[model samples]
Target: MAPRRYCRARLGGQSRWFLDRGDHLLDLQSAVDGDDVPALLRHLADTDVTWAPPGGAVQVDPARVEWQVPVPRPGKVICLGLNYAAHAAEGGNAPPEYPALFLRAATSLIAHDAPLIRPRASDRLDFEAELAVVIGRRARHLDAAQALSAVAGYACFNDGTLRDYQRRTSQWTVGKNFDGTGAFGPWLVPAADLPPGATGLSIESRLNGQVMQRDNTGHMMVSVTQALVLLSEVFTLEPGDVIAMGTPAGVGYARTPPVFMKAGDRIEVEIEGLGVLANTVEDET
Candidate 1:
């Protein structure tokens, strides 16, 4: 069976789960809480509910509902850096033997179509298009072969960064964690719906409607399965934990004439199977 697509949205000031049933958006939040992916999947499996037409089940217009990050408050947001060989080379560095890992706070992320704030502290705001893996089951110390089973779905992610701050230190935490910089969602596509590990899909990023970065998932130096297995070696990977499988080449900072995001600019990250995540840039007040 093909997997279903799900989204977390704010309707009438309340966050809810929405099922994309092709013709209509079903309000799954009314049936089950949006927090548990595995539980929601089970509920969907057992239910025989039919999708309601637009404004049938939920009277609110989807456009009126404010979008929220698919996983609003994940326990951990693990990001991979230099996971693509081309990206590493573009940055003037060689591929590392192990994945360069980093952490992003939930506070740093905003939902699709929301504004991504360019911090007042820096003008070097850059965009990174990445594939986000959402963990459905708890996993610890699993091998590469068993790691992919723990993933529930995939989503598009923009690992927005403050380049100047990011280069100030060896640690990337501060530059990568600017509040409301990370743009995630649009929706989550179930793993079974796409090729294993989301490989072979075209992943690209656009700035103000112009293509800025383009690549394929198959080009990742560190594959999703390997990332999960490697990460689990340090600590347990719990449900709701996210792994951003890193960005590709053609980043703004790597260009001959660097191009960074500024206020009023729109940025979008699109993955072939996962859908598009679009956000506008706003200056921090």
Candidate 2:
């Protein structure tokens, strides 16, 4: 049997684990408690018994479930800025020796298919397609050689940005932290089932079915292993922590005539082997 993907969904007003079994969804929480990465992997490895849904019926249609960000409240949401050389050149920046890191608040995140709220304070709502890495084990001061081992899985992410605010100052905190700007998830693919470090995968973004940005994961200035190694040097990475690898060239603000998302536009970030993360834009009410 193929390895199962996992997602968090809101059903009956409670958050629970939903297993992606290809043709149908299974209530994973019915089979195990605590959907943390390590625990989930252990449960799968220790048992050969087929997991059945509660009462032997599919609890909810995946399309109908209210998707929640895979890691609803990650301890740390680290983002890499201008980590792609082509993106850097477009932005008129030179490649840096170290990753340009920034932190995002939990409140900035929205789930797959959820609306990305464009704040009235800014009209430059830009889309950045990125590959998100979810850490499973505690890691500190690790080298690149051991970095991949610390990861649990990978997911699709949209690093929605308020460009005007981002350039208001050298610090990008305010612009990147606007509520409901980060769209993550849909589901998480376990690392064991994917190519190591998810390298060479095609990553792209589309606005209302029109391709806006596209690149391969192999182009990142800092690979997953290197990013993990550098990050752990600063602080201990705990389970559920997320690292959003930087976007590639072709982001809205870098184009000759910039393209920004507005109300009613559907934006999608797709990564090969990971899956597509889709969200619609909504004006802040």
Q: Assess every candidate by TM-score.
A: 0.92, 0.92
lDDT of 1 by residue, 2-89 (tens): 4467788877666778876565577766565666555644433333434343445553456666788888778899999998899999
lDDT of 2 by residue, 191-264 (tens): 77677888888999988998988899999989999898888989899888899999998899888789988999
Model 2 misplacement above 4 A: 1-3, 34-38, 41-59
Report, for all candidates in order, the number of backbone clashes. 0, 0
How far in Å is the alpha carbon of 251 misplaced in model 2?
0.8
Q: In model 2, what is the error at residue 236, expressed in angstroms?
A: 0.7
